[model samples]
Target: MLSNRQLLVLQVIIDEFIHTAQPIGSRAISKKDEVSFSSATIRNEMADLEEMGFIEKTHSSSGRVPSEKGYRFYVDHLLSPFRLSNTDVDIISDAFAKGMIEFEQVVQKSAKVLSDLTNYTSIILGPEVFDTKLKQLQIISLSNQTAVAILVTNTGHVEHRSFSVPANIQSSDLEKLVNILNDRLVGVPIVQLHEKLSDELTHLLHKYTSDFDAAYHYLKGALFDQQSVQLYVGGKTNILMQPEFKDVEKIRSLYSIIEQEEEMAELLRSNKDGMNIMIGHENKIDAMQDCSLITATYSLGDQQMGTIALLGPTRMEYSRVISLVNMLSKQLTNTFHSWY
Candidate 1:
């Protein structure tokens, strides 16, 4: 356990380091308005804190930086409630005031706004379309041999694929197929569409069309082949501006991981509901070992819709980012719930 003075000293050091991304000295803590101690007394507290594994002296200087354990303690015990500035509130309000109609549009805008506000890389995992019930599906003919298959979910998310129509299939058969699909799969969740099609809808297709097997194979491949969740990333280059990421190799490794959308989507999805913080090595991804990940989940009623995350150096503005994420998540939930 830390004394009250020790906790205050640690918080001040971490807060300063977070802002400047530079090591902090006891003299600096003494200069803060809230700190009442002399430099000598603050130095003694700093030494004690470092001995307890909360802070470390950088090799090149006498100034101290918060270690991973220090950051953890600060997040868990020392963080004060952050009040949102009017600018922050205005930015978020303006984004939602644009009359966006789709969930993807709202989430995409949120990601961009978050990145712009904090200058940190922002990632949003869009709601799992599989869990959403199919609202409608249509196949529109662009030409004699080309057509587009469009799928819309109850949440107003749209997915479409354009493919060449098989020569053996007739236009009338396509209409019949769509009618049968709407009748049978209207309320079915998208995740089960494949199994439901194979197990139950195949026989119905065979009864309506002469080229049942070939057409079934083609339609399935065209519509349900790629069902993975979508990941939206913004300000990927913003991480380049952080002083800690000056190393070229570090940037390269981080970029490679971000490029793997599937991996990132899985990582975001694995976080539990509400706010979560992973500092430095606490994050499982090797490339993220030098960074902190702050994630907050947005929901529709009781069901979680997606995650909004900010990634930056371990010396992140945790209080402000946490407040922003929490507010944004609530706004997202309210917007989504209004739809239902």
Candidate 2:
């Protein structure tokens, strides 16, 4: 319901605050070439905007700062479509130009590219397990009582877990179990591994070893127990550079949340396709109240494979970051599609 002048004034305040991270005064808005209003007229608009909850006055200064509501309105209405700088496009293109044959390599590199380009922490959720097929499963025994289970996907991603060998299962039993799983479970989608093991392989495993029950138990504990999605994080320390994160307790909480891979993966997966933005208190997570998160998905054909996200203070460079994320996501989709 804001008039054209009020909208312009709000946009000016937000843009200025984003750039300088300082409360903006009406005199400053008047000084801008895009603003034709005089200082007195602009001050009147600021007062109305503050009354409407779009802007707030800081205790320390007469100047105003954009409230969370102000940021939301700016993103939803005043944001102009932005084109990625040539340097940004080239950086992304060059990063992907190298031959990256594995999914891990591509995802890890993408994470780094985003963090480096934006100077913000970047997170990427690897392709969901349901979409990936098993390429190999191997068990390497460290001792008679302990061993490690390795799961390899067709995309060249590897996961390993250590477990105590069941008392009834010998090294020979482990070998036989691995052979049977490789024969029957290779090429099976990861999401179906448990079902395939129960319905299809139980009898086959019994046929190969007398310790079939122990082997089945071991397999469940070692391999299927791992998380269904993998999280890749770049520039974990980059958030420290933002002025808003100077509070030690806030940084500690944010870092703790970031380290929880399962929680973060779930959060990223919940995002709908295309680009979405959450600013300040709009984010559900308590620790992210002072930040903004921009997320986009990369896909193979129609199926979404993973997510790309950037995290920074709410005073983020929205236009530039939005453009960068959109371009990077498209590049990722093309790269993945080319691989398939």
Residue by residue across 33-81, what tens digits does model 2's lDDT show? 9888789999999999999999999998999999999999999999999
Cα lDDT of candidate 2 equals: 0.88
Q: Which consecutive 10 residues in model 2 have the weakest lDDT in total?
A: 297-306
Give the C-alpha miss distance for residue 318 in model 1, angstroms.
0.7
Clash list (residue pairs), candidate 2: none
Residue 138, model 2, lDDT: 93
Best by TM-score: 2
Number of clashing residue pairs, candidate 2: 0
Candidate 1 yields a Cα-based lDDT of: 0.91
Model 2 TM-score is 0.95
Give per-model TM-scores.
0.94, 0.95
Question: What TM-score does prediction 1 earn?
Answer: 0.94
Best by lDDT: 1
The alpha-carbon deviation from the true structure for residue 187 of candidate 1, after best TM-score superposition, in angstroms, is: 2.9
Superposed by TM-score, candidate 1 places the C-alpha of residue 7 at a distance from the truth, in angstroms, of: 1.0
